[model samples]
Target: MSQLTGPVPDTVFPRLGWVDDLVVPALREAVGALPAAEARVAGYHRGWTEADGAPVESTPRRGKAVRPALTLLSALAVGGSARDALPGAVAVELVHDFTLLHDDVIDGDALRRHRPAAWSVFGTSAAVLAGDALLVAAMRAVSDVPCRSAAAVAELVGALMELVEGQSADVAFEEAPAVSVPQYLGMAGGKTGSLMGCACALGGVLAGADGERVGGLREFGRRLGVAFQCADDVLGIWGRSRRSGKPVGSDLAARKKSLPVVAALAGEGAAARELRALYASPHPLAEQEVVVARELVERAGGREAAEEEARRQLAEALRALSYARPSADVYRQLQEIAWAMVRRDA
Candidate 1:
């Protein structure tokens, strides 16, 4: 459980660079090759143009496409042709975008990838419809996988259900009087971890890996997902406003029951008391109070605890990769990517 205490390192997967080049083209083609029904649905869902003369590109600007890369790479790692996994790649990317579109609307977020969010540019109704369209498109894309693998499609659907359930819990927790560490973990596992697991599982499935190997990759993805969320929690608190493209302590101000706050509430003595007071108070937290609240959570060992949990999850992910018995090179590359994920500055 080594701590990634400094700057993130370069990717271990050299092939990942090559995959990056292929991904955008593959995604574009996958979308383009869809049946007219699916294509129209996706275009409408993305809000590419309005009925009026005005045009707005609701398509989210290009993202890193990390999830799809993982799916394609996992397929290659397990001895399958990356080309065979293209539909899975397209399906997962569409699902991710769908979630983002809905999430932006739910969170009332204005910015995404440095541009106005879909909900901000189009109305919330349009954004919601777009998200729905993307989701349907994902299913359509997966259905086109040449082998007609029912298991892979079922796994993807299960992951989507888990995602929705997890999101439900997240919204519920915000309204709860208090949230425990376990509850927070459960929400994160559902909302974030499941999709990553699906990516890896889909890869293994496409490669025709044995059950044990597929299970191992699934666990690896799940652990990495948890670590990813913990890292996000860390950023939500201590990240610089300019660097994160949001105001610092924004989570605290929203009174969201994130992990750090949960840990402080569950810890020993005065720091815990002060946090409770802050949570209980109706008055807006002043700038200095926000700083003090962060320090209090750290002093209460909440920050350390969260970091430890992240490390634990990362170690578990590495161990799962061992079970997959990947090539030493591939394993090391995955480990490097995992480390970079936790250590990323943005």
Candidate 2:
């Protein structure tokens, strides 16, 4: 129950060092292998270089390497060398970046990590093409793994399909008159949890773990991923816009029907009624309405409900992790990282 409210701990997971040392380097090499134009766009999007190919230090460009870290950590937890899992780790990270590049365009987000989004900086078409390149690259990386390559590719393909479905649901929900909490949770799991489960499963499979252990690792990641999305919903409304690198109430302004918003609308209360009326308006919400929408969601106990769900999911993740029976050190690190993810301030 340690607070994860401030600066990132030096070690997000025990194998984070491996991600930094191996997975990141491998990603760079993969991007470098792209065609010149595509490589430039991918490199810029990754925060490794500027749009003009100038070397610059933009830490914001390098996202928190959680997925790759999970891949490597799960490998080590299963008594496999991180080196053997490098390709899978690289594939997972590339898939994440591919989704981010396309998602920014889909969400009409102009900024990411306090900088212009890839689409804004490099043009939408270039960003999209770059994303496509990354997706292909991810598949190639996984398919090239020496052991269990076919299974790894299958896992990634399944996750990517779920990602598309989830994103479609998210977009459709914006126009739908009502969205159930169950539907919202399902979308959350699809959008955020699927890849996480795949990442862990790939690691365990690559490590030659038994099916039961692999299933346990995947369950751990899946629950943690859902918790991660719930925490993100809280941040979308209440977190500092500057710190989180987005506008305040960004989701509210767009009528995104995120978890909290959907929950608030589902509640049977005066505040829920008021919230529905506000959402039903044809026009996009103005700044003042955005502020009021946040308050209404809170008043309807949406924030509290979402926070409780996050904690509950995290606990489930921990239980699943325990089922995996990782070494003591690995278990402690994974537990800490899971808590940090759900309890983060931004």
Best by lDDT: 2
State how far residue 43 of model 1 sits from its true place (Å): 9.1
Q: Model 1, residue 209: what's the lDDT? A: 82
Best by TM-score: 2
What TM-score fits each model? 0.87, 0.94
lDDT values of the candidates?
0.74, 0.83
In candidate 2, which residue pairs get closer than 3 Å at backbone N, Cα or C atoms, i.e. clash? none
For residues 196-314, what per-residue lDDT tens digits would candidate 1 score against the true structure?
Answer: 88888788887888888888888888889888888777777876432224555877777777777888888878888888888787666777888888998888877777888888888
Report each candidate's C-alpha RMSD, comma-separated, in the order given.
Answer: 4.0, 2.3
Clashing pairs in 1: none
Which portions of model 2 miss their true places by more than 4 Å? Answer: 1-15, 58-63, 241-244
Worst 10 residues of 1 by lDDT: 45-54
